[model samples]
Target: MNAKMRNDAYSIFSEAIAAVDPAACIYRSVSKKDNELIISGEKYDLSRYDNIYAIAFGKAAISMSKAIEDVLGDSLSSGLAVTKYGFGNCLSKMQVFESNHPVPDDSSVKAGQMVHDFLEKTQASDLVIFLISGGGSALLTYPRKGITISDIARITDSLMRAGATIDELNTARKHLCSIKGGGLAKMAFPSESVSLILSDVVGDPLDVIASGPTVPDTSSFGDFNEIIERYEIGVTMGIGGLLEDGLEGVIEETPKAGDYIFEKTSHYLVGNNSLALQEAEIRASKLGYNTMVMSSSIVGEAREVAKVLAAITREERHGVSPLPLPACILAGGETTVTMKGNGSGGRCQEAALSFGIETSGLHNVLLLAAGTDGNDGTTDYAGAFADGETLERGKSIQLDAHAYLSDNNSYAYFKETGDLVKTGPTGTNVMDIYIILVDMF
Candidate 1:
């Protein structure tokens, strides 16, 4: 392994993650002065409202809620924060509940109901502040009548395994849940509300982040049907019945543009993939590398993306690309894995394994791909590292890289090679980061 290059890669990635820390993002976006609260240049006179409540959900819920409490201090009239299991922290003025992610469970149902009940206490004179981040759709969910949590989980798993995009997955989720697709905004109607969001989706579409619980949804039941057809997702009888009811107009649609429910509601994008990439670029430059941010909206199959990245690395090495030797390239965005084998690994790990195969025997080239949230796919490792010797290292241990890649078992392969990147649960989510470093001999 090129230890210096590997260290540089980790350093640049950490700087990127720090740039989008949920607490820092919240602090930068919100503040209070006397009896007035200001957020992103909008001022709300606290004296005009009978109460001020803060509600947060997603992986960043706890850290975000803590930041809100610091800004509002004693004026915060209590709050509720729901996060993925093992990501919760104790807060002074808020109650925290840990739930499941990627799939909603019984705890998710309870959190959803709790949020609904909490919002019921809001009145026309109250103000609601919603902190939304990635994974909120699964962490805070209240299934519509006739649909059980099990049904939601089954569908979510199916869509994911089928390699559905975040937009498609969230569109389906918005229809099946009671509180997504602007339902939360409707619940707090008559009470002025503001949502501070940390976007984990490509292009930062407010309507798709956390299934747009507070923002107006551009998609409809028809869109959901199109997604199902595109992915060939098998729908259970109960879910199918609900979809039919939604299509027939027996069930109301989610709030859309120009809806009255959004009259006093505001949504702000506080943190995103671009912000993280910019910081990474700066850090890489400081490390004496010719750095460039490739793109912040990269998406598609993980293995295919890895192939392209490896090709770029070779181009840069040969002076065919813009950056010369000792160059660092960065990209950010989530990728999907079409599960073909019963293996444990996330998109980043899968990408790493594929990149390793494509760049075998190359000198002084390294790749690091990891999720900013510190959890990649279903594994504890955030991602993994790949280099010219990655395959050789595995071969010496009787490990076949091609076999592991074919089985979609990158996690196990990287584990034996000791290249898995583990950072535990980072208190923020901006999506995934990919770093490629090419060094001179």
Candidate 2:
């Protein structure tokens, strides 16, 4: 690939991925006409409900709420949106609450209580529009009856550090939270509710998004206890008492199927990582590169996946006979990194470093990895990118990509080399997008 071709390919792929960003594609999936909102081809009339309210939690909640305002206009009675600090914005009728993410804090605890209170206030004829998306798991934190906010926070931090997948992490959260695992829906029982979901989980499973505040949960408190024990997370005495009491059947289980709460609620998947991946593939094909979306459910440690993708790119570029050339391989999904060093970075940046070092000085190859949510880990940069020249740039600075990887400082390394891809916040959450373009020699 020549310089121009590579740059063109990068631009095409970047825009394609951004096209499905929460800020761009969410409105396409939902629209409002008067008192009615259409979501995913289904029409819902908000006028029928006497008390119309909204509860949005996630990185995309602010933008999603804004979109709702565009449709609902003055009819929005009351609502709440809890997001990370810098991501918060004003909405006419909805109160914006900003809190810590990846780790719960006092602010998250207070906001969660408000969520529970809001749910309790819903009447039978009320319309509860639940805006669900990624990052909500932490944003919507409300500990179970006996558990304290500190207990929940400690467990969450441990699970995250243990490299637990979202599924496993959420399973533990479901058991510890008062509003997760369908508990929020249970609170709004008999009140008509609709969940507008921006899926970040691979395959977009209903039960995993934001820990499924409105979806039915199959896991039990026992399962949650096991996870806590497995991770050896310390909990408060109150939490231990509550768990023991619950295990003894004192507390009623969370709402289940056949419950009135679930009957009155409807869940809709609005957008996901797969959509972003598909869009990227189409754009790559139009740019004259043969493209295939490898998978949207890509998982495992971030570094491992990057190494695997690097090997594949190397094979295809060298044309070991049957492998295709001049192709771009795309993937979307969330990946985790186990933090050991004091360094800072997210999964996408880690993947970039891993790929950068492995494919160093190999011409006709470029790799881009970014989180569609526009924030990777705790950094402002979404992710990073690398071409054949990445290693040379690092070498000039006397920085070893491998050492940075060991310290989980991918973002710092990439930023120094001017390879960090910053998108701020895209307003939509669909996890991460990985792009690899192989050029014919």
Candidate 3:
């Protein structure tokens, strides 16, 4: 391993994560002056009607909520937030509930009910400041009364293991839940609501981030059925009845675009993966490395993406370049993992393992992949790293990288090679980041 180059790679990644800090991003985009709440470019006067409240969810919930608390101060009446377990702290004005991620749990159901009940207490003259980020779909879940947490968890696990895209997973959740797909907006209807969102979805698609709880939704029950059929998942997995009811129009659909409920709501995308990538690029350039923002919306299977990245790195190494020598290539966006084995790993670990094996003998190059949230999938690590020596290190133990990759056991492989990134929870999530360092300097 070129220790200096490897060190630089991680430093650049850290710089990217810092740029997407939810609280800092909120501080930059939101403020209060003379009873006016200025969020992004829109201004809402707090002196207009009555109560002002805030609600937050996702991995960055606490930080975002705190930022809003700082902005609203005495004007804020009360608030609530839901976040992944151990990623939150007690707040003065905001009630924090911890829940599961990548899957919903009982705590998630309670959080949903709590938020709903709180909104029920508001009147037409009230205002809600929604601080939304990623993971809200799971952290803030309230399925129709029939679908239990087990039902949602089973179906979510099925879809995820089947390699369903985030849009597809959220599509299914939106139809089944009463609190997703603009359901929260409906709850806050007649009361003006401002959502300051940090984008975790690529291209910042409003409806897909946290299932677009506070934005107008264009997805429908029909869309949900299409995904279920396409993936052939959760059919008799216990939630089939919910889908049947949805398709038969027996259940009310989630709010759609131009719905009256959205009239009182405004949404602003404060930050996203692009913001993180830009900061990483700046840091890389300052470190004297040519940098390229490869693609901010790259998505596909983890190993497949790794191959493409490795191919690019090989080209750059041999002078058939995309940017130049000593260059860092950065790409942002989340990837999917199809779990066919019993192995433990997240998308970042899977990508790193695959990339490591692919570029095993290529010197002075480092391939790093991690979640901006500092946690990936079900793993404790934020991500994984790979250098030229990654393969040799595995070979020393008679472990074949391809074998581990095949078993979807990237976590074990990286852990044994001591390449796993253990940054713990970063208190924020903007999706996954990919960094490749091709240094000849």
Candidate 4:
């Protein structure tokens, strides 16, 4: 491995994450000016509202809540924040709830109930501040009537294993949950609310971020059904019954663009993957590499994406690419993994391993792919690194990169080669970052 390039990769990744830090994102958009509250250039006259309450969910919940507390101070009534397990922190003005992620458990149900109950206490004159970020779809789950949390979990797991996109997964989740798909906005009806969102979804679609609890949902039951059919995911009996009810119009659809419930609701995107990628480009350029942001909406299967990136690395190395040697290529967005093997690995790790195999024996090229949330799938590591030497390092220990990749065991492969990038609980999520560096010796 090229030690300097490896270090620079981590530095660039860290800078990207810092750009989307939950608290900083909030502070940039929210502020107090005497009897008025300003958010994203819009002013809210504090005297007109009876109370100002806050509700936050997703991986950035606690940090975002704290920033709100600082901005509102004693004027802030009370607040609730629900985050993934181990992402919670003590706050002076708000209660924090910890729950499961990538899958919702019983605790998620409880948290959803808590949020619902909290909204019930609000009056028409009150102002609700919603702090939303990635992971809220799973962290703030409330199964619809007749559907169990286990059913939701099972479907979530199934769709994920089948490599469903975030949009597809959240579409299915929104239909099953009472608190998602503008359901929270519906529940807070009559109360004016503003959502400060840190978008982890590509293109910052308000309706898709954390399932868009405060925004109008463009997806419909028909869309959810299509996702299920496309993925061949089998629904539980209860879910199947609910789907039937939805299709038959026995149940209410999610709030739409013209719904009155959205009249007083406003949403502002405070941070996103593009913002992070911009910062990464700056950092990489400062580090003396000719940096270029390849894309900020990268998607598709992990290994397939890795193949394309590996090809770019080769092009850069041979002086045939758009960017010359000593070039850094950056791309930010989420990717999926179709889990055919039972082995453990996340999208980033899987991509890194595949890139390693394709670039084996090639010198002066390195890649790092990691989640900004400091986690990748169920592993402790955020992601991993791959360099020209990655495969050879594995061979020295009798490890075959191809075999591990076949088994979907990138975690083990990277762990053996000491290439895992671990940064525990980064307190933010704007999806994943990929850094490719090609240097001319």
Top candidate by lDDT:
1
Q: Write the per-residue lDDT of candidate 1 for residues 132-222, one digit (tens) a residue.
A: 9999999999998999999999999999999999999999999999899999999999899999999999999999999999988999999
Error of 1 at 170 (Å): 0.4
Question: Every model's Cα RMSD, please?
Answer: 0.8, 2.3, 1.2, 0.8
lDDT of 3 by residue, 1-441 (tens): 777887898999999999999999999999889988787767787888689998999999999988888878889888998999999898879988899887999999999999999998889899888989999999989888677888888888999999999999999888778888899999888888888898899789999999989877888878888888888874654467777787899877888888899888888888999999999999999999999999889899998999899999989888898687789999999889998888999998999888888887888889889999988778899889987778899999888888899999999998888889888788888999999999984
* Model 4: per-residue Cα lDDT over 215-312, one tens digit each: 88999889999888887888889989988888889999988899999999998999999999999999999999998999989999999999999999
TM-score of each: 0.99, 0.93, 0.98, 0.99
TM-score-best of 1 and 3: 1
Clash statistics: count for each candidate: 0, 1, 0, 0
Candidate 1 CA-lDDT value: 0.94
**Residue 252, candidate 1: C-alpha displacement in angstroms:** 1.4
71 Cα displacement, candidate 3 (Å): 1.3
Q: Is candidate 1 or candidate 4 better by lDDT?
A: 1
lDDT of all predictions, in order shown? 0.94, 0.82, 0.88, 0.93
Best first by lDDT, ranked? 1, 4, 3, 2
Q: lDDT of candidate 2? A: 0.82
Per-residue lDDT of candidate 2, residues 1-441 (tens digit): 245654755676466556665545557887777767788788887768787788899988998888877667778898999988888988899999998887888888899999888777778888888888889988878887667778878878888888888988998788778888898888888788888888889888888888888988877778778877887777779778877877888887666677766888898777787777777877877877788888999999999999988888888778862536778888888889988887998999999999988888788888888888778888998888887788788889998888888999998899889888886677777888888888777
On the 0 to 100 scale, the lDDT of residue 130 in model 1 is 97
Off by over 4 Å in 3: 236-238
